[model samples]
Target: MPMKGLIWFRTDLRLDDNPALLDAIDKCDEVAGIYIFSENQWNDHNESNVKLSFLIKNLEILEKSLSNLNIPLITLNTNSFKSLPKDLNNFSVTNNINQVFWNNEFGINESKRDDLSAQILNNSNIHVSRFDDQVIYEPGILRTGQGKPFSVFTPFKRRWIENFDMNFLEIRKPSALKKSISLNNESSKIQYSKIHKVDIDLWPAGEDAAAARLSNFLELKSRDYNQSRNSPILDGTSRISPYLALGILSPRRCILEGMKLNNFELTSGNKGICKWIDEIVWREFYRNIMHSFPKVSLNKPFQDYTDSIKWRHCDNELKAFYEGRTGFPIVDAGIRQMLTEGWMHNRLRMVVAMFFTKNMLHDWRLGEEFFMKNLIDGDFSSNNGGWQWSASTGTDAAPYFRIFNPITQSQNFDPNGDFIKKFIPELKDVSLKNIHQPKQDLFSSSDYPAPMLDLKTSRLRAIEAFKTAREFNNS
Candidate 1:
């Protein structure tokens, strides 16, 4: 009898550089692909409808790609992770599958599900193999001199570079099966009540589209990325984040292509190329943080002192912030962009996050959940890390005193107010000087509200709050 293997697809959706998929293809005479849709799991995670739609669209594309390789993609629908193990085991038994392979996921719930699935498969006399394909360096591999996981990113990145191997980025393309296998057609339709307002045309699904976007960005805009990425008006940064978040594109492929542009130099090369690679490393760092510190995944702040900070509960303020009615032009613009596009610029994300956590004195988790509910590129680790960093509650977070002045940030990053004007048409006639900090007369005339809170006053309030929390925690 031929060895039948199943490749369970999760976030690692792409064909190229997929270690588990390649291994399955090499080890088994026949290979089948499976994707389980857990609506309960997605809702529990506060996943966006836009992201769900994107996933379904990409699965359709991936199905065709797998078909070409003579491997059938069987879609399974499960209400929650609790039933997934049994569903997987039953499928394996019914299909006479001898082995199962999958790429690992780092979330607390996801880790538990995989562990249970492994046990179920093993008890059923099936071999289960998992690969760490998400991060170049698997979690727990890099540690500080004290033999502890580095909580800070700088040293983590430094050690990451020191332990970097070019072979890690090598592409692994799967060969086609000698004989075609057929399975019952399974629809990948995902129906959710809440649909996002984002234009689907802006983000097309598929690996080819992702690869093309990466190539275009590298060929045209990568060289200027360092200088231009901070400016929200220019399309300097690679907008392949949604693809990356969905695993339509692999990080290995991204790093490999980026390295080719810089002659395979990870650190010493074009400043722009190195900076881009740094962002990739930042993503990996967040993943490692998720793996090392599971509390962050469980909605606990990394800095224990932050848990004592009294976060304000103002529904009106949060509503205004969410609806882009916040008086701060940059914060309002960023929220509006996210509402309409299902994505926001990286700089704007920091600005808005800081304004929420520092200026509004809201809990970082609130902003984190809001972003996850709306962002197409949302990943738990990155979103949580970013929010906690802005709130000074995470590992290597921004200093509590380093509150961003929204007006100053607006003037610096969006100098001409082009980005703000683009999103907020009511401010189109406002002058550049007043755009960042509108005068009372202009603010009223343009129908834009006055500054929500006094910036300096709010800054002091946040600082005092953090100080009190720290002192209390220490005492």
Candidate 2:
């Protein structure tokens, strides 16, 4: 019997630089691809409608790409991860697949599903193979001097650079297989709702689009990225995040292209290029945090002491923040940007998250969940890491007392207040001096609300709460 293989496509939606897909092609006379449609799983993870829609579109393109390579794409529906293992095993057995391959996903639930699928497949005498394509170094590969997973990013980054090799960036594109795989794969349109208000056109689909975006960013804006990245109005940051989130682009390909511009140096050369690469490594570090410390994946704070912090719950405050009427122009602008674009500038994400968790004295989990539910480019690890960092509840978090004043941040990053005006049209008429914090008279005239809370009082309140939590933890 000719060897038949199955490739389980999860986050990895593209073929280029996909180890599992390439390995399946190399090993089997015939290959098929499988994608599981689990709406419940998506809901469990607080996945955004925009992201789901983007995923469906990408899968459609991926199916066509796989067809050209003589592989059939099969989509299976399961309620959740609990049922996925059996469904996948049945599909493998029914199709007489001798081997199954997939790239690793570091999330707790994903890891469990993959493990169960492997167990059931192995029992049925089907060979199972897994590869790591998400991170240059597998999640748990790099560790501290004591063989422990490094919890802090700076040390982890230092270790990552020390262990890095230039050859790790090399990627191969798989060619068309010798023979075609004939299978009854679903050719119907994916069932997805168009409820997301985000303009999907903002993000072009497919690997080609992703590669083009990266190329354009590197060619045009990368040199000035270090200086311009913090400015919300500047198109300095590479918006390849959505592509990376969906696996339409591989990190290896991104780093390789970046290195080509800077003499192939990872840590040295242009400051902007190096900084851009650091962001990629930060993604890898978060994956490591998820893999090594599973508690974070379970919604628990990495720093357990933080759990004692009493987070205030106020429906009016949450609603105001959500509707972008929080009266803090900079913070509201960030919220409105996410509401409209399904994306927010990196600087604003920090400012908004800090204001939510610290100034508002709300739970970080609330902000984190809201971000994931609205962001088109949301990755669980990155979003969670960012929220926890801002909340002072995660590894290498900002010091509890080091709260960012939204007004100061606004003045520093959005000095011209163009970003504030662009997203908050009610503030368009406000002078530059009052753009960051409109006067009461201006708010009354424009229908913008007054500042919800006194910044100084709220700052003191947050500090006191953290101190109380620390005392409780120590006691």
Candidate 3:
């Protein structure tokens, strides 16, 4: 009789170099995998339907992959972790499982779920093991000499590069979970009779899809990524973020491919390709931030003082901003792109975030939640960090006085009405310079909406708010 274990899969959907999966296979005998769809958690976090669609598609792909080893993926339809312990315990006992294993997640409800599950398993006399697979280095692993989390990205990124070793990326083949176990081991398959209707046109899932995307990015567009990642008018981006967000592609695999290209001492693409890896490292950084200050995922700002700042309420203008009727071509373009495609360019994310929080004098949290509702690539930490950074209310956020001029940003990045025209159809007939500020000349009134509010006036209002806060705090 082999020592049986239950491998509970969470964010880490792939088998390649997954820390928890590897650990369980190393220590346990027959390993049975379970992926539970917790609607309770998704509702609490406001996850988009696109996200669920991706999960189901990836889970299906994972099932096919698991079938290769004759292992069955048992999906459990549970509402919440409050009763998961009792539920999982009964199932494990019936299946004759001896251990439970899973990876760590750093969200509020996620932590609760893991804690409740662990406590339940502990009482049942079953050993439980969990691993940190999401981020390359845990939060505390890399800290300043005074034993504190660094707010700035520069010093942290430098240390990350210095500390990373080549051996970490070596392909790891995990121990087999009882080599001959078949899908027939489970008495029956868990069913989710009432799942949301999912259309996966936006984000495709699986390890193979992830790998192919990486190959396409590296082969075709990587050379120009450094220059073209910012331009919405051009599609020269490495759009592997959705896959990376879902863990269909492991960071180690991405780093290995980048390193292989970067080590090409003679190629010019190496430098830009390596720079792309730094963006991947930024994801790790934000994940670690959430890990250290779990309250962030609980909807708290990184800076405590920011909580006291009174954000303006301009429901009418904010609506204009979100609907792409702001009359600023660049800002409007980003907003429309998000509404239509459920994703925006990384550069545009920064710009539109700034326009809303800084120029419109609106709350960053509102924009953050809106993005979560719409963005296909929206992760809690990254989106929160992004919105906060733009609003000057987060760790390493821009200075309160420094605000992005929407017109200037459009002229600099878009230069033409190409990206703006794609989303804001009314601006299709407007000229390049007029498109940047269609409301100024009243040129696009026939089809497009007018400017919600003057930019300079809004910018001054934002400044005044910050100045008042500064004076009050000083007093």
Candidate 4:
């Protein structure tokens, strides 16, 4: 009998640099791929429609790619993760798969689902193998001298650099199997609710498109990344997050390409290249935080004391913030950008998140969920990590008192207010001097709303709230 293998596709979607897919190809005579999607799972996780649309498009492209390798892609829909194990087992048994291979997913629910699938498969005499394709290191595997997971990013990054080996980034392309798998008829078309307002054209699907985007960024813009990344107007940063989020591209591919540009220097090279690589490391650090601290995944703040925070719940304020009419140009611009484009600049993300959590005095969880609901590249770890950092409620969080003045952030990052004007067209006629904080008369004359609240007072209010929460925790 031929050795038939099953490749369980998850977030690590691409064939390139995918150890699990390569392993299946190397060990089996024929292989088939399965992608199990759950609408209930997406809803529970607050997944964006834009992202789901992107996923479906990418899967279509992936199906064609796999067909070229003589591996058919079978799409399955389950109600939720609870049903996935049985679904997986039935498929394997029906197909007579002798082995199952998959890349690891680190989320709590994902881990649990994988565990159940593994147990079920092992009991059925089907061998299961998994590999890490997302990060250079498996989450929580790296530790500090005290044997605890490092919460601080700089120290963690230092350790990541020290332990890095070039061999870790090695990739081998898998060729077509000698024999073909006749499972094309079993492949089902993916079904998704299309409700996104974003222009899908902004993000092209497939690994080839992803590779081209990376190449363009490295060739044309990486050297100036340090200077231009902060500016929202400049296309300084690589817009590859959507690709990275879906595993259309791998972190190793990103780092390898980046390092190639930097002459293979991990830390020392063009300042821009090194800084860009640091952002990728930061993503891994957050993943480690998610794995090591399960409470974060449970919707609990990493800092226990933050539980005492008395977060305000106001519908009106939230509505204005959501609609991008908070009268804060930079904040509004950021919100509007995400609403229309399904993505936001990193610097603006921090600025907008800080304004929402600190100045608006709202719950960080709300803002975090909103981002996940709208962003095309909403990686839970990165979104949660960033919101918690802004709200001063998670590992390596900003100091409670270090609230950002959005106007100043606007001046520093979007000096010409071009980004603001581009997103909030009502403010296009507003002068540069007052664009960040338009005068009441300008707001009265235009459709743009006036500043909703006094920044100085709100800043103080947020600080006091944090102080009171700390005192209450201590008492």
Compare the candidates by lDDT and give the number of the best one: 4
The sequence of per-residue lDDT tens digits that candidate 1 reaches over residues 161-239 is: 9999988887867889997654444545554566778997899899999999999999999888999999999968999
TM-score, per-candidate, Cα-based? 0.98, 0.98, 0.92, 0.98
Candidate 4, residue 158: Cα displacement in angstroms equals: 0.8
- Candidate order by lDDT, decreasing, is 4, 2, 1, 3
Task: List runs of model 1 lying over 4 Å from the truth.
Answer: 184-188, 442-445
Clashing residue pairs found in predicted model 3: none
lDDT of 2 by residue, 65-147 (tens): 99999998887778789998998898889889999999999999999999999999999999999999989998998989999
Candidate 2: global Cα-lDDT? 0.92
Structural RMSD, model 4: 1.1
Candidate order by TM-score, decreasing, is 4, 2, 1, 3
* Alpha-carbon lDDT of model 4: 0.93
lDDT of 4 at 233: 93
By summed lDDT, which 10 consecutive residues of candidate 3 come out lowest? 190-199
Measured on C-alpha atoms, candidate 1 has an lDDT of: 0.91
Local distance difference test, per candidate? 0.91, 0.92, 0.76, 0.93
List ranges where model 2 is wrong by over 4 Å: 184-189, 192-194
